[model samples]
Target: MCYLYNVESQNTKGPGHSRSLEVPPVRVLLFILATFLGFVLLELWLYWQSKDKPLQLGLWDLIFWGLLIFWSVRVEVRLPLNAGMSQLFLFALALVVLTPPWVAPLAAFLAQWGGSAWYKEFFNRSQDGLATAIAALVWILAQENPLYLGRWDLSDGVGIAAAAFSFFAVNSSLVAFVIHLDSQTPLREIWRRNMGWVALSYILLSPLALLLARAYETPLLGGWGGWTVLFFLIPLYYSRFYWDEKVRLEEAFDTTLELLMNALEAKDPMTRLHSERVADIARDLARKVKDGDEAYAQAIYRAARLHDIGKIAIPEAVLLKPGTLTPEEFALIQSHTTKGAELLSPARKVAFDQLVYNVILHHHERWDGRGYPKRLAGHEIPEEARIVGLADAYEAMTAGRPYRKAKTPEEALREVQELSGHQFDPRLVEAFTELWEQNPIWRDRHAYLAAKEGSVSRSTSPQRSSASASPSPSEPGPRTSEE
Candidate 1:
């Protein structure tokens, strides 16, 4: 009983408190080591696949990376200084100067100078550079924190996790920003493509850094090295996806524009065959003038297809009249050029807007200053548009209409050559004649039309249908070589 009493006194807290604690640091270290090895192997495999080609860095690329890094470091260093609005003013000024040198100079200048003017003129009358400076200061302060030290801490397990997350955040942000700026791609698209890279890099590199930190007891090595690897990986990942998407989207846009042109042909049944013939002739002429110039070929095709879109506004009575139009009717018909310009203006917001808009607006302008609308002449008419105009005239003259008999191929060519300087661009006419002479199909179509003079039906006149009419010769009766 006495021994029991003594033992109870020793355990005065009312319990047997004699348990040993196990830290298990070695087990944690081993786990981290294993994770690091796995990640290294995966990264090696990915790098081997992607590193087949040599890295050719451009001047602009170097400039952009240098500026980004500089800005990042500056933010890191000045965060704790409490420099207020002055710091922000300096940052904005630096951006204004540096951005133009890397991005488009004209775009940067307009955004900087014109944007400031617009803001002052419209939104805030009293706001000045100081106000902008203050706003920038607020933004910098929000992003800065002393504990961050421009790097993540990975001494403890929690710190390792934090470091991994930060690596992803920083690298992903940089990649997305660069892609958006360089490719002129949408922000959402950049994010969609780059997010996977961020994830993969984190999965592969974070564990390795954590293991190295634990093994070496130098946490900075793992944290900093992991971030560097992520930085390089981000751009690599984006390059693969960006180029793939760019090519696909470009091809899709080209196809869509071509289909739209074809639709324009379908709108007018009578003009469908004529448009095709003109497009062929115009394309040939364009090749002669500017051989292998894709821009010229595309412009010719677009202009020829839309040359008669203005005719949509013309009345059926005037379009299909068996005889010549009255002075007022002819004037109304001439208004098609302006109407076409108006119709195509809305579509100018698309990808090849400038080229398409030029064709739609200026195809009717003649070599001389006597053309309608703007009366632009010679080189001002646009070379491709001039080619289309010439081809259109040649096709219209050779193709019989209800009002007039089709001319012989020789007569049409002679007429086109005669009115070269007055009605069309002389150089374009010369190119067109050369192309027409070389193509036998064109010669045969014209010969066939010339022989079937007065063969087109004037009974079912254009005044009957407000919509387009079909130009099939066999629908009513078979057409002979001569009517």
Candidate 2:
């Protein structure tokens, strides 16, 4: 289940595919209920803070709120951020600066209504108003009379930045959490993938939002005089367009890669979805090994997936062969590592990473120096390749192959343990061994369910060493897992 930018929708319960994925009913209700409670609490706090002043709505305020509702609904982008992007923050900042504390949440609700209708999603509205209200409350609490925001002084930079930071930080965290709940993906991965890159975007845009708010009040350039603010605003829209295009291009790339995976599977049924499973497993292994380097973990996942993509160039006869291959045939098959590296070299134009290439070329190399075109050993092999190397082997062992029956998870784990420090990096083996204990059936369960209860039972079996290499397309190297 490889996820695209939209994240994987394994159990899509939306009315139709036209709508983006939604939070489950239970979570949505919980989130909405929490928002309502928070809204009530903030209102009470603002009332006390404002010396018991009643929240009043005047016609002029209504006019401004209407403009906010309009822009927030119409202007939006899908940046690297998981949440849908909206310049609504611009007007929310304005409301906080120009109006009293209680008005911000009221305006947020009205503004979110417009966006809800535009997106036609109830869950979207939940997060939309929820974040703005929180941001408004933060601004109110910060300045008591954040009315100073009307001044837009560089002297108050610390306070202004604090409110602005709270707004985005709370909003991004809330949205990322919802995404994690909906997707059942790890929360850390979700944050790194969706929220990490958006931080700079938010930083660059926050001051502009405040600037626009301040400019709107100046008699010389405000709307009351003329549309002078448009001069500063048109560029932000352009930037939004640029970011939107970037997201679209990324989607296109993911779709293209998915299509390639489909083609690879079609060419050889033995490999059908094998890479995806390996990718999932490899990612988990990478997390255990590195703990926090998400980008590197993703690279390892992609590398594991494409480790055998070079097989695309090998003759189908050799790929699908059901018996032991001759020496020449084995050698031809082994060339896939180099061939894959060559095939992917052009991706540099698209900013494809060097680690992907390294993993593809070196995944077959053993830790003990007995493997591959380079015969690289131990620390000489890239750690990324080592991670995928163990993952690839695990997948091959647990899965049934054309040449031999699948080993149970226990058997596979035992074999991997035996190969530690020889076929696999000792450190990675320790990491994977932990995962094997935590969840031997992490990928799929059929094998583990039927596997012998203990590794000791499988110790006497004949191991697939050099002579058994290249038994079939399924088992194609001295190390079947790397193959």
Steric clashes per prediction: 0, 1
Model 2 vs. true fold: TM: 0.82
Model 2 lDDT per residue over 61-85, tens place: 5575557555655666654434456
- Which residue pairs come into collision in candidate 1? none
What is the C-alpha lDDT profile of model 1 across 1-483, one tens digit per residue? 000000011112334432122122344334334433433443344345435534343565434433432332222211011100011122222232222212211111122211112211111111212222222232223334323435863233343344344434533443344334334555554544335323554434344433432332232445433334335435434543553465466557657656755665455444435666677677667767896554566567756666666666667777655554566776676677777777767766665456555665666666776565677878888776677777776776666555445566788788788777876777777777776687546554534333334344433112232123322221131111111
TM-score for each predicted model, relative to the true structure: 0.43, 0.82
The CA lDDT of each predicted structure is: 0.45, 0.65
Please identify model 1 stretches exceeding 4 Å from their true place: 1-237, 255-259, 440-483
Output the worst ten-in-a-row residue range by lDDT, candidate 1: 1-10
